[model samples]
Target: MAICTHHPTMKQSRTNGGRKKEDTRSNAIRQSSGISNHLFEALRALRYPDRARLLWVDRFCFNQDNTEIDLMFSIYSKATSVIIWLGKENPVTKTAFEVMDSLAYIICRERNGAGMKGDNISPFAMKERPSDCSLFLNGQDFFCFSFSRKGPKMYRLPRHGSLGDDAIFRFNDDRLWTEIDGILSNSYLERAWIVEEVAAAAEVNVFRGKSNMPWSVFWAAYLGRQIFAFKPHMASDPDASYGAI
Candidate 1:
């Protein structure tokens, strides 16, 4: 289970003698003392019943007395992965995850069906690249992916002509749009440190309520929603297909 350092409740402490006070050196005591009920619930939700999970919790790892912003950069960049905790689930949250899961499946499946390997896709690798891989393609143009950390790798996606309007019909749900809003409205997205935490990590996973998903899937669903919003124009063009996902 991971603990987020950005939670306001856990960060609050009283100053002493007209000066900023320092925290105690005992990491265990400090972590145990600072955990609020909300954080407790989040940690409980992330617990594994049968196995122990190795977590790089910022609250336990960072020294509050000597907290350095540079350490945040080094820690997240070097870690294997990052887990984003969005606290306990609510009624809407479950529906949101379900919708995102369904949408993500369709999005990835469409790419795979077009001859692209799903396993080769990485959100971190593709973050700065074009969201719509087909947007800049000509008939002879090669659609390629570049990776920096995971060795020098490239993927040339075959031109599958057009993906048609079949996938568009699947996303034409008001419920999906509502759920997308619900997912984005979570307070975890508002944290100041989240930007660095997400961007620097090699892999990122999101946990909300009882559901957990890869950052790639979440990003695909959001992109799918954007494509859905412009369905009218997208359905008209043969080349500008569902490849936008």
Candidate 2:
């Protein structure tokens, strides 16, 4: 699968432009052959235990030239999966994933067709969910997921209750939705190209630090919240808007 990344122009420097190539703005950002600071930060945070794992980031895969570029669609379509990088992790990252996971688990396991309708899970579901489902007993909150007839078991949560990042953990609705909105409002989600990239891929995975979650589950939780907006986010509410376990 292709790794789909969104380029955020926050704190960006002007690319080098010369008199010869005036029409192309490519040289401005393309002046340097090195990767962007944000990309470098993501790469450094990535924990690939082995020697080094190869990833197809746009900065490295394609030429930096801004003119006559026509490979974006083909690249996305050819990818088996898309890795959407939200940003560096924060305290809210972990809680956001866990709550989203909890909601995904309930809907998939209970087969609640009324809420989600026709399963948007086909494109975004995980192809290989972990074999072990560990449930922690203490007051800690966690999520356990099960797939339908054809899919793999999706999420196997950690003991600390963190999602993908090292964010603080909690299962409360007020705390949960508050953290979730923080993530959803990130600059990455605002990019125009993200829609085309996500739509073209078969599976979409979102990552931050050590935590990760399926894009379908995350999206569903966001939609679920909108559907059941009348009540508060606490567990007592049956709407499942905040994605409680």
Candidate 3:
């Protein structure tokens, strides 16, 4: 259960057998406050079906009247991990994350090897077979480590003024590019506080429904998208394809 303040009356009780009935008592204190339906949906989506989860909500935990802006940075910095809620998942989210997972996995692997420096920073590398896999963020399979468990095939990104033939073939699908656009165009990324929160976070996990990916991976994929757009090949229709984000 989430530990929150602002409510009063901390009633305590004990069972006859000498065991405390913690579940029987209300976990959070009762108070009257207007909660947005969007926030409610986020809280519901984060709940664990089999067990309780300890969550810290800024609105509930922070004393807005007395709290300083610096406190938010400190809290996020010290927290175990930051969860970035991107709202309920849909077909667009699923497709976007699938592409991101593959690209980020490639970036991770490269970082461990020769490192992402020089021209190698681009994700235009190849493997045995293309990863035609999909991750369904349904039920209890919402783990961030799932991508590391099985290696997904990586697609190529534009590099050195051109998208190589192999990369061009892989990126033939306009639908795939559309999904990538969807991720960047999400309104959640435009929040004013996100910059400080993410900058202060020790670890960041982005969530869209049950689907999740590391901030490093997501950022890398985003950078790749930017690089891909400005390639010489895309210069012909720059205005039509690339819009300022």
What are the Cα lDDT values of the candidates?
0.49, 0.48, 0.48
Please rank every candidate by lDDT, starting with the best.
1, 2, 3
Lowest lDDT block of 10, candidate 2: 236-245
Model 1 C-alpha lDDT per residue in residues 1-245, reported as the tens digit of each score? 23432232233222122112222332343376775545555545554555444455665456634756556766777665666775566555565675565445445554645454543343323323245453313333133343334543443333333542233233365444444555644445665776787778666677776766666666665554443433331222222111011
Q: Write the per-residue lDDT of candidate 2 for residues 1-245, one digit (tens) a residue.
A: 12543223212222222334432443344346465545544554442433443455654556536731355656666555566665566565676676566544434432342344554443333333333642222334335453322365545533344443223224234655655665554456665666776776656777765567777666655553333333344432232222110
Task: Give the runs in model 3 whose Cα sits over 4 Å from its true position.
Answer: 1-33, 59-67, 105-177, 190-192, 230-245
Ranking by TM-score: 2, 3, 1
Error of 3 at 23 (Å): 18
Given candidate 1, what's the lDDT at residue 241? 14
lDDT of 3 by residue, 1-245 (tens): 11111112222111122114532332231222354444444555665555555566654555545745456666666555667765565554565576665455444444545466743554544322334532111112112332211343233322212323234324655555554665555566676667877787656667766766666567766554544443222222222221111
The regions of model 1 sitting more than 4 angstroms off are 1-32, 59-67, 105-179, 190-193, 230-245
Clashes of each: 0, 9, 0
